[model samples]
Each structure stands twice: as C-alpha cells, then as structure tokens.
Target: MAYQSLRLEYLQIPPVSRAYTTACVLTTAAVQLELITPFQLYFNPELIFKHFQIWRLITNFLFFGPVGFNFLFNMIFLYRYCRMLEEGSFRGRTADFVFMFLFGGFLMTLFGLFVSLVFLGQAFTIMLVYVWSRRNPYVRMNFFGLLNFQAPFLPWVLMGFSLLLGNSIIVDLLGIAVGHIYFFLEDVFPNQPGGIRILKTPSILRTIFDTPDDDPNYNPLPEERPGGFAWGEGQRLGG
Candidate 1:
C-alpha cells in the first residue's frame, strides 16, 4: 500500500557541525592553493569566500583539514548533535538548521571583519551554535566512553579557551546577537505558507524556538537519530 511518512515528530541539527566542517575544508583548500604560509590566509577572502568561486559555499564543507583538537572535537560533537537533532526533528527539517548555521556563521564573520577581530571567527561560530544548544539542555552525550555528560560543555569550554588565549570576546558576543535576530525573523514570518510549521522555537527567545515538546513516539535510537546513518546502537549507548 502507498504510505505517508510519519508526521509524529521532526528532526533537529546542531548549528556548529556545518560551520566547523566549512572552516576545516576552507583551511585545507587554502593549503592546497599554495597559500599555507602563516600570514597568507589572514583576511584572505580567496580562501574564505573561495576566490569568488560560485560553488565555494557548498564546497566549503568538504574542504577541511586537521587543525588539532578543534577537528577532533568537531567530529565527536557533530556525531552527537546531528543525530540528536535528526531524532528530534522527524519530518526531515534538518535543512532549516543548516541554513541558520551557515547564515549565522556568515553574519559573524562579517562582523568580525568589520570590527577587525578577524582572528576569532571560529570562536564566534561556537557561540552562535551553543546558544541554541543550551535551550535543549536535556541533550546529553557520553564523554569519550568515560562518563555521560551534558550541559553543552564543548562550546562553553572552547569559548573559555579562546578567552584565555587572548582572543576577542566581543566577536562571539556580537555573533550571538546576530544569531538571535536571525532566529526571530526566520520563524515569525517565513516566506512559504507551511514554513512556519517546521519553524524552530529557539530557547534564547522567550516566545519562539523554546524547547519544542518531545514527540510521544520519539525514540532517539531507532526511528529518528540513527535511522539515516544507521547509528541506532551507537546512539543508544551515548556516542
């Protein structure tokens, strides 16, 4: 019999996964272009904007290279959050999350350049994503097979490290502001007639994007989180 997809729940996506993936790829491609030198990449739109490359925006996610702990943390965080989001948002609305992430990162990067704190672009990225993650604090992950931990520690810890490294905090603060405004406008009045139904109620804003109620049938393990990636078992044990 012809069947309709279950509409019992929707999927979600953590904001950082796309941008962090984008940053790593950009760094790798920069090196490939013989632009590996320390000073070459700074304020280099050629790499960030992909030399006016029309396809750069999409390619950025695949352009990453290892940048020490940042890359490792990203891999782990992405697995956990992406799965959680997918499980939470069931009607395949993960695309909306990605849109917010990319646009938010772009806004932060723009502000970073305007204020001359170009170096802390990544810091701003985490801030933009973390604010949303906090709203859904019930989310948790196993800490490297050690302990079950939550509270969105990765983003906040990274921010602290950035501060200790003498990086600019204003950029991150400003990025959060930009994300807040973006979230508001995206929901309350979207273009498509049915778009509002898929809209997220972010916790940061008092009214909209609040912690959306968990679906009664929402089983983070089977039906949602790992179904696409087949992460059913991995997700259950807390990856």
Candidate 2:
C-alpha cells in the first residue's frame, strides 16, 4: 500500500478501459502550453521555475524526442497496451487501472533519468520493453500482431542500439527506463513470490468500463513482450 500514494480513484469508478484517453488529454494540455518540444521543457528552467508547479514530472512525460514516423503509431500502441492493462486491473474501477499504467510510465521515466546519470546504458535496458509491454506481464506474451508470440523486448533491443550509437543515445535509453520502473516496482516485484504477496488492485473505483468486452475502440495491438510475467520486462528507446 506504500505505493498507493499515486492514487487517482476519482477519474472513474472503475476508470476507463483505454488509458490513451487520459494520455490524449495530458498530451493535448502539454501541446496547448507549447511544451511539446524537448527544448521548451527539459532545458527550460525559466518556464518551470515561473510556474512553481510541483508536479513538473507530468510536464516532462508530455515531451518525447521523437521516433520518426513511428511516433504516432507507437503511441497508439502504447495506449492500446495501457487500455488493456487498465481494464484488466480496474475491472469495474477503470480509473485505477488507467492510473496504474500511467503511473508506471511516469515512474519508469523518473527512474530511468536517475539511473542514467550513473549507468547511462543500463537505464535504457528497462525502457525498451515497457513501450510494448501491454502483454509483458503475462507468463507468455501474446504479441498483438504476428502469428506467434515473442517478448517484444524493445528496451533491451534499443539498448543494443544505444551501445552501438554512443553518447547522445543516453537520453533515449533514459526515457524508456522511466516507463519500465513504473511497471516493475509497482506490479511485478511484489507479485513475484509464490502466492500471497502478488500485486493486486485495491478495488478502488466505483463503476467504469470493463475490458475485453469487444468495445469498438478495442484495437488489436502489435505488442512486444519480455520473458515470463516480468522477465527483463524492459527496453531502450531509439535516439
């Protein structure tokens, strides 16, 4: 329950099945504030200092260093995975479900940043996987697309790329690490042992959207996964 500190049970009783709805809202807000670029946020001390906003982390999540044309498509993929995660955990209280995923993303980013300063390349090892980790928690990931399944271990894959690329590649790795921590610490670790200590949603919301109900928005994702329920559930971002 120590982690329950990140609660947002008020969004929806069960919250919404698709977390992208929230992502969209947050992203939109950042765009409106003209903070969509890395220059405006990561380097701008004046804006952040002037706002005096405590939750500056939220602002950072809104800015990505771009992934070429794959950005929009990948974000959509992230939303899909997040939606499923929210629905599965929240059940009736979708808000908590959404919060869990969103929080995981936020936490991983922070953790990645922290670790990057010390072990730059290692931070990304966690980031790549999270990007396509919707099915990551499963013992065996059913990749969204493809005939068979595989651990879309994007984090590590990206890490390999970073080690080869050098220097500037650190930021991308750090970004993915941030997303990985959110899921690993909050869900995977506690739930690891044999029976009782597994992570379980606290039944927080009132009423909300249920998942796998075949909602129209329910899309088929082309997700990547790691090994086991949380095996190296990680990835490194492309810079």
Candidate 3:
C-alpha cells in the first residue's frame, strides 16, 4: 500500500533524527489524546529528585504540545535540518552527531534549571537549526519569501519571528546560546591556533553508533543549489 511504503521510507531517515522526531510526534499525540498532560511531562527538578520522576528530563524535550501550527512548524524544521546535518556534514559520523545531541541536551538542561522553561523541545529544535545553519554558512535562506540571508543569521531570524508570533524568546535564545557554545567548543576552538580538541566523542559512543565498515559506498548528497524561488528557501548554490 502507498501509505505503508511512505511510512517505510520515512522510517529510513538517519537514526538520530528519526528517533528524535518519532519521540516528539508520539509524545504530542499522547497529549492530544488526553493520555498525558503537559504538567506531567515538563521538567521539574524537585519532582525528578524527590519523586523519582526522572523521565521528565527526557520527556520535557519530547512534547512540543498537541497538534497545531507551532508544533507542526517545529517538527518540520526539526526533521528537515536534522536530516540535512546528518546526511551532509555528518554523512558517516554517526557517533559525532549523537555526541552533539548529548552535548546540546546536557547544556540545555543545565540552563533550564535557572530559567522558568518547562518544555525544552522548541529550544532543542532551535539548537539543531543553529548548529546546522552555522555549519552551512554559505547556504542561502529566504524567510517567508520576503527576506534573504545567509545561514548563520537563520537562528536569530527565527528568534525575531518567534517574538513576532508573541512566543517567549527565552527558549529560542537558550537554544542559540547552547548551540553557539557547542559550535565554538567542538568546531571553532579546536581549529584555533594552539587550541586542542576538548570535546572528543566518547569511544563507547563511537563503537556503538559508528562502525568501521559501515556504508562504504555511502556518499552525501550535494548541497542544495541556490537560485530560483521555492517555498521556504533553505538551499545552497550549485549541485
């Protein structure tokens, strides 16, 4: 059946992105179905420590809310850029990608303690967008087909858009901050003069997610060719 085939194709998305998106969808559906409540899933340090509701740590980053425009928008962006990053810069580096997720999530959680943020799914999405945007600095993006800017400015643009939507910019700012930290430590700093790599991916993670002989024939797709108008332009020039 077409539906089954489509499902199968979607299931073939890179592991980390696929898993994260699936978690978000399922959590949202559960809440919409009234099977779970946001209060139960939100991050609460006291509940996590005293009542042992540690699942909140992960769940808080899973549900964005019941099915709606904001949820859909976040999910689409999450899936698209997460997949692009995995298949582009991280083509064969599954362990490194996983480590980035771990690092970002850990940092966000720490920041959440000081802030009043309950759900961090949006922030996590922003972190992904920020990392992807930074790594692909040359990529050209069009915001609602009205504004054009290079990739590095994408996160800030999103923050401004969030402000326009009357959403708190705190979550977006948290994501951007965490993302910049990761980018600086993992990508930027190590390449600096006399700078050594401080954020090495763990060997155990490498062993599990990355194999020596995996996908020998795999090759990353070319960056999105720039030019021409398209819906939600997020592409690079040339094939």
Candidate 4:
C-alpha cells in the first residue's frame, strides 16, 4: 500500500522535473555504489574535445558529489523549483521548458570552459530557481524559517546560504548570470520598447514534446493571491 501511494505521488510530478531529478539521483547512486567515479563524471574540455568523451557534457550536470547533506539539499531544491516552474509558468509548454533547460545548459557549458568548476548540477538548480522566482515575483517565500522575502530574491538567498556554509560563491553566481541572460532575453527585453522576442522555442521541439492545449482562455499561472499568498504558500527552504 505504501509503495502504491508513493507511485501515485511520483506520477504527479511534471515530466521534465521527474526525468531530471531522477537522473541526478541515479547518477549519485551509481557513484555511491562504485559503478562510476566522480573523475569520470567531472567536466573536462580536453577529454571531451580530443578524446571524444562527449558524455561528460551531460554527466557533469548529473552528479552532485556523494550522497550526504549537500546532495540531499540540492536534490530537494532541484525537484521543488523544477516542478513548480513546469506546473506553473511553463504549464502546457513542455517544449519551452525543455528549451530553457537546453539554453541554460549550453550557456553554462560555454562558461564552464572559463571556470575551474568540475560539477554544474547545483548551478543548474539555481538557474531553475532564478527563472521561477522571476516569473512569480509576487510570491512570498520563507527561507528555513529565518528569512522572509518575495520570490525574486530566492537565488540570492540560496547563494548567501551557500556562502554561510563556506562554499565558494562562484557556482551560484554563474547560475544567476546564465539565468539572468535567459530571463532578459526571454521575458524582459522582449517586452521593452522596440524590442522583439529573441528566444523562441523551436518548432521541432513543439512537435516532439508539446501537446496542443485547446482552451483559448487558459492561464498558465493564474495570479490568485488568496489571503495575500501565491503558489508557494506554506513551503520553505528545507521544509
């Protein structure tokens, strides 16, 4: 009975979130089981270009170090924000969400070339949180019951928390930079005077992943702030 209930809950998660989170968990599990090593998963330009180790590009964004507090923390944030974004702003727009993933990953890969970072899964998670926070600016958020703020400040809060833990702020900054670039291109710049939409979801992606929604009056994210709250009500960091 417990297994059946868990299965139902798992099925409730959006497809993109489910797939990405599962991949991260499984990759970490493989390392824990000695099936793979972190050395094989870390990003390396030389191995990728000269030795044709192209899988490193994707794997680097999969493993988030060993299974511990840090790994669990990252996984929770990754699954939560990814699910919320998919089910909220990107609702019925699977292809566009997938496109965002690809766009962020591509930019991070380019930036990775210039940085000393090995794994990028945490940065990718921050990118998701940043994009979601931007799209839901009015949502009230509580971080670990210590700080309360609006959604837009989430990435920074996470970064600050990372700094408190003595982790370098470079990874968080990289994610925020990529996320900002994407947000500016997709949302902000397109709405400015004489600005045009620059980041378009590819039609092939539409055909492949997007299901046509027939409702013409559909609201991807309805701004219903009952009791002065948004979709993230009663949720908090590490809760």
Candidate 5:
C-alpha cells in the first residue's frame, strides 16, 4: 500500500517536471549499469557539428554524473523547484513553461560552445531555481539550517556552497546570467516605463496548454502548506 501511494504521488507531478526528473534519474542509472558512458553525454560542439553527434546537445543537460552526493543534491533541487514553478506560477501555462525550458537550454548551449563545461544539468537546475526565487521574492528560505534569506538569494547561496564543495562556479554563474536575462525581459522590462513586452507567448502555445477560464479574477495565492511537499516552505538542505 505504501509503495502504491508513493507511485501515485509521483504520478501527480506536473508533466514537464516529471519527465525531466525521470530522465535525469534514468540517465544516472544507465551510467551506473555501464550501459552508456559519461563521455558520450558531455557537451562537445565539435563532435556535435562535425561528427553529427547531435544527441550530445540534449544529453549534456540530462546527466549530472555518477550516482552520488552531487547528483542527489542537484536532482532534489531540480525536482522541487521545477515542480513548484510548473504547478505554481506556471499552472495552466505549460507551453510558456516549455518555452522557458527551450529558451534557457538554447542560451546555455550557445554559451557552452566557448566554455569547456560538460554537463549543463546543474546550470539548468540553477536557472529554474533563479526564476522561481525571483517570482517568489517575499518567501523566506532557509539553507541547511545554517543560513537564512529571502527567496531571490537562493541561487547565489547555492553557488557559494558549490564553491565550498570544490565544484566549478562557472556553470552556476552561467545559469544565473541566463536566468536573470530571461527574468528581466519576461517579467521586469514589460512593466517598466516605455517598456514593451517582447517575450510574448505564441498563440499556438495558448491553444495547446491553456484552459478556458471561467473565473478571470482567479489568482493563485502562494501556498502556505507545510514543507516536504512542493512549495519550498520549511524545506531542508538535502532531498
């Protein structure tokens, strides 16, 4: 019964988040089973363009590394925040959410061409975290019970922690940069004086992802539920 309930709960996750997290997990499992190698997954522009190994472009962002602490840490953050963004602010806006994914992935891939970074999954996770943090600025967040701050600082705090972990800060920085650009254009600039909305969601997206609303005034209040769910309230350090 317990396992059945868990399976059902897992199925309730938003489609995009569920698919992404599953891919990451399965990718890691495949690596652990020696079915595929890390070399095949890492981003390599030369190989992608010249050798027609185009799978690397998408695969790069799917695998973090072997199954261990870093993989677990990143997967937790990815599942939590990705689910929140999809179910919270992006509720009923699947197409727009997907566009954000495409936008971020494209920018990161372009940036990856210059840098020697391999797996971009961490950066992609950070980008999602950054966007969620900005959207929920008033929400208080506690990290590892050692530090506390408003939501917007979460990505930077994670970057600092990454520095402590001896991991490269470049990927985190890249994610932050891309995330900020998207936020500024999508959310900030359009509301500013003399600013026009440039990042319009396509009509096809609306037709596909949007539901006809009967209550136009309906606004989703920030969830005040307990943590260990999706809202990040009372969330702990590890998964």
Candidate 6:
C-alpha cells in the first residue's frame, strides 16, 4: 500500500519535470553505485567534438555530485520550481515548456565552452527558478526562513547563498544570464512598443507533447500567485 501511494504521488508530477528530475536522480544513483564515474559525465568539448561522445552533452547536466547535502539541495529546488513552472505558467503548454528547456540548455552549452565548469545541472536548476520567479513577480519568497523578498530577487539571493558556501558563483550567474535572455525574449520584448515575438514553439513539438484539448479559458496561474502555493507563510524555501 505504501509503495502504491508513493508511485501515485510520483506520477502526479508534471511530465517534463518528472522526466528531468528522474534523470538527475538516476544519473546520481548510477554514479553512487560505481556504475559510472564523474570523469565520464563532465562536459568535455574535445571528447564531444572529436571523439563523438555525444552522450556527455546530456549526461553533464544529470549528475550533481555525490548524494550529499549539495546534491539534495539542488534536487529540491530543481524539482519544486520545475514542477511549479510546469503546473503554473506553462500549464497545458508542455511543448513550449520543453522549448524553454531546449533554449536554456543551448545557451548554457555555448557558454560552457568558454568556462572551466563541468557539471551544469545546478546551473540548469537555477535557470528554472529564475524563469519561474520572473513570471510570478508578485509571489513572496522566503530563503530558509531567514530572508523575505519578492520573486525577482530569488535568483540573486540564491547566488549570494552559493557565495557564502565558498562555491563559485559563475554557475548561478550563468543560469541567471540565460534565464534573463529567455525572459526578455519570451515575456518582455514582445510586449514593448514595437517589439515582436522572437521565440515560437515549433509545430512538431506541439504535436508531440502538447495537449490537444486544452481549455481556451483556463488560467493555470494568476498574476500574483504561483499555482496556489504559498511561499512566505513560515515555510522554508525549497522545503
């Protein structure tokens, strides 16, 4: 009975979030079991271009180090914000969400080439949080019950926390940069005086992932709330 309940709960996670989070956990598990090594998973330009190890491109964003506090921390934020974004702003628009993932990943990859970073999964998580916070600007956020801020500052707060931990802030910054570029393109620019929509979800993706019977009048998330989840009511961020 317990196993059945757990399975049902797992099934409730939105599709894109479910798949990505599962991949991250399974990749980490594979490493923990000694089935794979970090050396094989970290992004390598020469190995990818010359040796044709294309799997590295995706695997690099799967493993988030060992299954300790850092790993758990990243997984929590990744799962929560990814699910919120999917079930909120991106609801009934699975194809567009997938496109956002693709767009973010592409930009990160291009940036990764110049930086000496290996694993990008953490940065990818930050990007999701960044985008979600931007869309729900009025949603209040609390950081580990210590700080309170509006949605737009969430990404920077996260970066500050990373700095406090002595970790490099480059990954977080990269995610923020990519997230802002995407946000400006998808949400900001098109609404400007003479700006036009620059990013369009491909028809093929819509055919493959979108729901055909989406309600025309449905609003998954309101402008001021994040899919009905309360963030600053004595709950810890990422809890």
Of 5 and 6, the candidate ranking higher by lDDT: 6
Identify the superior model by lDDT, candidate 1 or candidate 6: 6
RMSD of 2: 11.2
lDDT of each: 0.47, 0.43, 0.86, 0.86, 0.85, 0.86
lDDT of 4 by residue, 160-204 (tens): 989999999999999999999999999999899999999999999
Deviating ranges (above 4 Å) for candidate 3: 216-232
TM-score of every model versus the real structure: 0.47, 0.46, 0.92, 0.89, 0.88, 0.90
Clashes within 3 Å, all models in order: 13, 34, 2, 0, 0, 0
Error of 6 at 208 (Å): 0.6
> Tens-digit lDDT track for model 1 on 161-195?
55876856575567556745664566334766655
> Which digits, one per residue and each the tens of the lDDT, describe model 3 over residues 1-239?
99998886776687888899998999999899898889999999999989999999899999887788888889878887888889988877999999999899999999999999999999998998898888988888887788888889988988998999999999999999999999899889999999999999999998999977656444443346456533235767562
Query: Number of clashes in model 2?
Result: 34
Whole-model alpha-carbon lDDT for candidate 5:
0.85
**Residue lDDT tens for model 6, 39-59:** 999999999999999998899
lDDT of 2 by residue, 1-239 (tens): 64463342323312342333455446545665676644444423344458764344444444333543334433444444444444444334554554554555445544544443322212322343454353443323333232233345544444554565563555555556565555565556667675243334454432343343544433332223444332222232331
Scanning candidate 5 in windows of ten residues, the lowest lDDT window is 230-239
* Residue 119, model 2: Cα distance from true site in angstroms: 18
Scored by lDDT, model 2 comes in at: 0.43
For model 6, give the RMSD to the true fold.
4.4
Can you tell me which runs of candidate 1 are displaced by over 4 Å? 1-66, 78-83, 119-121, 124-128, 139-157, 183-239
Candidates in descending TM-score order: 3, 6, 4, 5, 1, 2
lDDT-best of 3 and 5 = 3
| Runs of candidate 6 exceeding 4 Å displacement | 214-239
Identify the runs in model 2 with alpha carbons over 4 angstroms from their true place. 1-40, 43-51, 66-80, 83-93, 105-149, 162-239
